[model samples]
Structures are given as C-alpha cells and as structure tokens.
Target: MKLRIAILGTRGIPNHYGGFEHISEYVSTGLVRRGHEVSVYNSHNHPYKDDNWNGVSIIHCYDPEYFLGPAGQFVYDLNCIRDARKRNFDVIIVMGYTSSSVWGSMYPKNSAIITNMDGLEWKRSKYSKPVQNFLKYAERLAVKYSQYYVSDSMVIKQYLARKYAVNSRYIPYGADTITPAEREQITPHEARKEDYFLLMARMEPENNIETILEGYNQSNSEKPFQVLGSTDNRFGKYIAHKFKNDSRIEFKGSIYDTAKVRALQNNSYLYFHGHSVGGTNPSLLEAMASEALIAAHNNPFNQAVLSKDAYYFSSPAEVKELVETVQRRDTEKLMVSNNVQKIKNLFSWESVVDGYEQYAMECYLDFNNGKIIS
Candidate 1:
C-alpha cells in the first residue's frame, strides 16, 4: 500500500546540517524506494535545487533562517505541521518535538502520529527555567498526543514508560553518513597524523565541550586535541577562547565536511564525548562507526548506548586518567570498535529505516484494516 507521509522538524529533506535533517533525508529516501509516497517538509533556508528528489516530494520549511533560532523556527515548524495536516497525510513523523509538538497536539482525528523523540530537550542544562518549562510543555504535548513515539535508547524508553505512562517503541540510532569505505579513505594527516584526540559537537554548554577541553588540558599535555564543532551559543565562544590559548587544543569550528571528521576519527587514538545531555547523539554513533576507543561522560544514556563497554569520565582527574589508560589499552580499543560495529550494524540506517518503515506501514495497514488506533 502507498503511504502519504510528511516529516516535520529541523529543516527538511536534502539536509544541510543537524542530525534530524539527515534522518529525514535517509528515512524518506528509504520510504520512497520502498514504493511509498513520501514528502519531506524542509526549512526554507535549506538549500536544494529541485523540490522533488527521486520520487520524494520535498516541501520547503517556509522561512527558516528568518526565525531567530528556536523561537523563530518553532513558528516555522508549526506552520509546516499545519500544512502537513492540510495535505491529509497518513502519518506525520515528528522530529524535534521541542519545536513542533504543540501544533501536532492540536491536529484532530486519529492521524497516525509517530514522533522521533530525539532526547529529553527540556532537561538540558543551559536553558533558563522558563525556557525549559516551555520546552517541557511542548515535549509532553507531543508525547501525550502522538499515537506512537520512537525512543532512540532504552534509557529514554524507560523514562517514557515510567514517567509519561506511554509505551514507546525503541529504535536506536544508525549511521547514514559514514561508511567503512569512507573510513578507509581518511588520510592520516587529516585524522591528526600528529598526536591528538577527536571531539565534535554543537558547542553547547550541556554537551560539556568545556569540561572535556579542560579535562584534556589537565591531562598529559603532550597530546594535541582536534574539536570538529561549530559554536552558535555563548558557551561555545567562551570555551573556544579558553582553549585557544593552548596551541595543543586545535578548535576547527563547524566542519561541514563529515568526511574530514570521519577521516580524523579513523586515524585518532580516541574520541572524547562529553555530552551531559540529550539521548542517542548522532555524532556519537558516527564516531562509534569509525570504531575508535571512546571516552564518554558517565551518563546513563551514554553508558546504555555504549553498553558496559565505553570508558567514562566525570571530571578532569577522571578524564586525565582514563584518557591515559584508554590510549594505551589494546583490549579497550578492540572492545569499543567491536561493540560499535555490532550495535551500529543493527542500528545502521538501512536496518533502522526498514524497522521504521515497517512499523509505520504496519500502523497504516492496521488503520486501514480497523485493527489498531482508536
């Protein structure tokens, strides 16, 4: 059966940046290939020459850059969701509920709502109380209203079941950008042929870029660090200045070339993940795909994702010690890469999207069969 669906959130198909955008690109492409009708609503700022790509209808997000960050983007997304409803879509795949959930909740009738609740956005550390509360309102609205929510990690799934009383389906992250061939293509110099570790993130306070950089500084200073990230917020700038003083800490701001990051990851001795917030980060999964020994922050989300396998660091002392140990460990290296290889295969874009497409198709099939949905 052909399914009419619209994906809403963080720009649209032909993704420019951001994790969810890539997801929309890959998932919609997968759906299109599976003989389903798919349309992706993208941000107006998202650049793409044609509105249609290989049978997938790409809808412009309607003035994305016009919006000043989330406040502006939230309004843009609400319009997209409303437009999606007007199109009489079979299912609306909502990504980034923090922005679009409020509008999604108001859509009447039993539309199959499948939300990719990427993470607990409201609980992030940097946002103010009111801002956080507003996000919480939006988050819960999406959770309570959507027919189904895709929890990317068991940790978040458990949170949903216990806290929201909503039974979410667990669909972990997958890598769409990085491939084994891509990894092999990375040059040693680009991967910091010199002595260094790799860290890439959004330069957000909650991601703990500072903590990791500071921790690295305190550690053996012989090794340099390569941070492939873009700074859009105050915290990012602050950390950049603090670390700029150290020639050893090379902050290559906002690298759009993922291949470069992957190349770096391929040749690096380790990948430093300091994110204290969010669930199932795409960068983490991608880094894991490179199969480098990972030293991540000791959060249950990170721990659960890496499963009893990844190294942990909560402070400078811990980071220093663990980095030293991990760089030297023959077993740790093999274990992390092997585990990443194992999990990532199951979570590969092909597998994850197939699961999503099947689940989505099942929901639609059930709806048509009068077996599921109210």
Candidate 2:
C-alpha cells in the first residue's frame, strides 16, 4: 500500500546529529524506494536545505533551539506538528517524545500517530529531578496521543507494556555490514590497525564516558584509547580536564566522517560501549556490524542485542578487567564473528526499513477500518 507518511522530532537528515536523524535519513529514503510518499521534517538550520532528498520530501521548519535552549525544542516540535496537520499524511511517526509530546494534541486528528518511545529519558543522569519528572509526563502524553508505538529494544517494548498497558512494536535501529577499511583510512588519526581501543558516544553522564575512561586509565594496556564525540559540553570539558595527564587517552572530538569512523571501529582492538540508558543504540549496532569485539555496558537493552556475542561490563573495575584481559583468543574471535552475524540477520538497515513499513501499513489499515483512533 502506498501511504503518505510524515516523520517528525529529529534535527534533520544527512545525519549531522544523533540516532533519530540517522533513522530519519534511512527510513524516509527507504520508504520512498518502496513506492510510498514520505516527508521528513528538518530544522531550518539543517545543513541540507533542499526541498527534497533522494526522492523523499524535506519539510524545513524554523528551529530556535540555539538561542532558546531546551525550550526551543518545543517551538521546533510545535512548528513541525502544525505543518504536519496541513499535510494530510496517512501516518505521522514521532521519533522521540522528549520535546514533541507536549504538543501532541495539535497532531492531526485524522492521521494515525505512531510514537517511537525512545529510551527511558527520565533515567538519564544529566537531567535534574524536575526535568526527569517532566520527561515522565511527556512520555505519558506521547502514549495518550499516539495510536501506535515503536520500541527499538525488546526490553523497552516490555517496559511500555508493563508500565502503560500498551503493546509496542519492536523495531530496532540498523546498520550495514561494514567492509573493513584500509589501514590508511585511520592513519590520519594517528591510529594503527588493531593497536587502539575505541569508543564513540556523546559526552553525557548516562553514556558512562567518565567510567569508561577511568577504566581505560586504570588498565596497563599500551594501546591509545580514542574517544569520539563533541567535548564542548560541560561534562565533556570536565572529563577532558580529569584525564588531561593521561597521554594514552586521546579525545578525537566529534568525527562525522562515516568511513573513517567505521574504519576506527573495524580496526580497534576492542570497542567500548558505555551507554546505559538507550535502547538499541545506533553506535552499538555499527560496532557489531564493523566486526568490533564489544565491551558493552551491562544492561537489559545491550544484553538483548548482543546476547552471548560480546563482553559486558558494569563498573570501572569490570571495564578494567576486560581491557587488560581481552586478547585475540579463539573465543574472542568467535565473539566478533557472532556479533557480525547478528547484524546481518537482525539489525541490517533493510530489515529495519521493512519492519517500519510493515508496521505502518498495519496501523494504516487499522485506522481506516476504525480499529485505531488518535
């Protein structure tokens, strides 16, 4: 079925930002390729200002987040929803509820709203108590306003079902199986193949960046630990200062070059994933696809994805042990191979797009048949 679909809640496409933007880029274009009419709401300040991208329509809305701070996200989301109300889209997918759910009532009444319930936002260590409460309220608003829900991890799906009495479709983020990059691809970063430890994540408290760095510092490994992501934020600056004396730890400030990033992941001796609050993080999927032996934060979300395929760590001590003990043993090689296979069988971009498409069609059918109302 060819449905008119609208996607909201990310900064923009071409993935200049984080997870949702990447998902928007892939899902919007993928749906278009499947003969559906898809439009993605992009921020006016987005790098790509074109009206269309790869056959998918790009609706740019003015965003004031730069000047208004967190309050600006509400304005941006309001603009997107107001514009969506006029588009007459058959299905409107809301990527995350942190900012947009407050304006949920403004979403078009005739459209089938599907909210992708992002990680438990209230659990993040960065937010204040009041902000966490507000996020909880926002999550409830999203659940009340949407006719359907999407959970990227089975754990999240179960959480929504248990907490809100709602059954959400499980649709994970995806990554392509990466071809190992040439050694030269990482030479510019001063990294040699299989000679460095790698980590890629936003510098947030919940991401456990400090914990991972502390663990790396405690270990006696000779390999340099490369940290990727912007360090302009408060937490970033603090961590950078705390680890300033550690010559072995290098902060490679945000690297957006996908090929280079994948090369680093592919060539690393071990990739540390310290995200503690997200569901099926795109970085973890990318690491797995890149055949990186992962040392992931021990949590239901990460466990669900990696299963028995990767090592798990809960604290700095555990991370230190993994860092010092992990080697190119036959068991470790098997773990890397198993992770790559998981990506191929479960987390491929094609499968992710297919899940979204199928769920969207089901929701559209139910909406038209009076089984779903928003």
Candidate 3:
C-alpha cells in the first residue's frame, strides 16, 4: 500500500557521514521507486542542499551543531519533531534515539513511530559516565514512546527483547557487491592489490584503532598496514603519535570516495574490523560485500554477522598471530567466495529496503486499526 513516510535522524543524505545517512539514502530512494511518498529531514547545513534527492522530498531543518557542539543535536532533533508533527506522516522512522528520545513525547500521534535502536550508545568508551547514563535513559524513552522498534543486528534484537521486553523487527544495513572489473579501476596509490593489510574505521576508542596498530606493529609481516579514516579526534591523534615511528603503518585519512573504499576493501590482504560496540556495522558488511577476508573483533555483534566466515581476534597477540601465521592463497580464495555469496543472498540493498517497507506498513496498519500503537 502507498504511504507517506518521513525519515528523521542523521545529518542528511547523499551520505557524507556514517551508517544512518547511508541507510537513509537507499531506503528513501527505494520507497520512492515503489510509489510511496518519502521525505527525509536534512540539516540546514548539509552538503547536499537540493530540495529533492532521487524523487524523495528533503526537508531542511535548522541545525546548530556546528556552533553549539553536542547540545545542538537536541535543538536539531526538536526542530525535526516540531516540524514533523505538522506533516501528518503515516510512518515516521527515527534512525536513532540518541538525541530525539528526549523529545519523544512531542512526536506526532498520527504517525506510527518506528525507532531503530542502534547499538547500545551507553556502552561506548568515548562518552563520559554522565553522558552514558543519559543515553541509557534516552533508550528507555525511545522504548516507551515509539510504536515499534527496529534492530539492525540479532544481538541488538535479543537485547531489546530481554531487557525491555520489547519486540523489534530486525533490519540490517546493506552494501554493494564489488566486481573484479570495478575493483581493478580504483586502487589506492599507497598499496598494491592484495599486498597490504587494511583497517578502515572512524578513529574512536571503541573501534580499537590503537589495539589493531599495536598488533600489526608487533608482527614481523613486511606488508604495510593501510589505515583509512580521519584521525582528527583526540583518540586518533594519540593513536597516530603512538605508532608514528613505525614505518609499517600507513595512515591514509578519511577516504570518502566510494570507489576508493571499495577498491581498498577488494584488494586488501586482510581487513581488520576492531569495532567492539556496534550492531551489524556497515563497514564490516561492506567489506564482506567486497569479498575482503576479515579479521574482526571477537564479540557477539561481529560473530552474529560473520559467523564462521571470518577470522576473529580479541587481543593484539591474537591479531599478531593472524598476521604472522595465516597463509594459503587457496584458502583465502575460498573464504572470499563464501563472503561474496553471503552478501549477495542476504545483505543486498534491495532486500534491506523490502524489510523496511514491510515493517513500516505493518506498524502503519496497526495504528490505523487502533491496536498495539502507543
């Protein structure tokens, strides 16, 4: 059935930032193609200033995050909620509860609110204890106020079910599968194809950037370890300083060009994912889709996605072992083939978009029938 849907959260999309923006771009465009009206809330200062993005309406809201810091997100979310309350959308899918849950009571009753409760924000090591406590409260508010919840990982889904006694639909982020031809065209100048180890993640303490580098430094491997992402943050600077003298680590800051990222992933000897805190991370999935052999942090969230398909590591010593001893070009080829097939079957954008549409419609119908909606 046709519906008027609004997507709020994230800076805005043609995706200049993280996972939510990437999801917003694909989901909104997919719904528009399916003949539903979709509007995404954009920040007034978003790089993409266009009113319409791939047939989806863009509503620019005032964002003071640039000047006011973290406090500005609350204002931006308040602006989004106040404006959305006037739109009378059939389904309003909020991406995350970080800032918006505080204003949850102001959300329009006419819209069926479905919140994607992202990985436990309170668990991030970067947040102060007070901020972490507030995140926990925000999560509770989201659970109490929204009509439905969306979990991007099975681990997250189980957590919500057990802790909050809340039922949630599981919908993962999707990625593009890279072909041999596409992979060949966008090689980074710093590394040869399949010769360098790669680690690409935002430079945050929770992502284990330092741990990964330490392990690589300890190992005797001759190939350079290419690190792709911005090191502008304090944690990143510290990591850089600690590993500055090591000639084996190449810190290539923040590669935003999709082609370059895909090329790096497809060509890497091994892709290290050190994220210990998120649900199904988009970067991990993207690496899987690119057919990169993975060495991910050993955690429930990572295990749920990679299963037996990846090599797991929890400590620098384990990462060192993987770097030093893991060999067999034939075995790596088989693993890459398996990951490629898995991404094609389960993590495609088309399937992810369909799951979102189904969930939104189910909640919309429930709201219309005056059943099970808050």
Clashes of each: 4, 0, 1
Off by over 4 Å in 1: 64-69, 108-110, 176-181, 184-188, 192-194, 368-374
| TM-score (C-alpha) between model 2 and the true structure | 0.96
Q: On residues 137-238, what C-alpha lDDT tens digit does candidate 1 reach at each position?
A: 888888777777888888888898898887787877678445666776656566555257888888777777777888788777577788877765688788
Candidate 3 structure quality by residue, lDDT tens digits, 4-29? 99999888988887899999999999
**TM-score of each prediction:** 0.91, 0.96, 0.97
Candidate 2 C-alpha lDDT tens digits along 63-167: 999999979999999999999888789999999999999998898999999999999999998999999999999999999999899999999999999999998
Instruction: Point out the higher-scoring one by TM-score: 1 or 3.
Output: 3
TM-score between model 1 and native? 0.91
lDDT of 2: 0.91
Q: For all the candidates, what are their Cα RMSDs to the real structure?
A: 2.4, 1.8, 1.5
**What residue runs in model 3 are displaced by over 4 Å at the alpha carbon?**
187-191
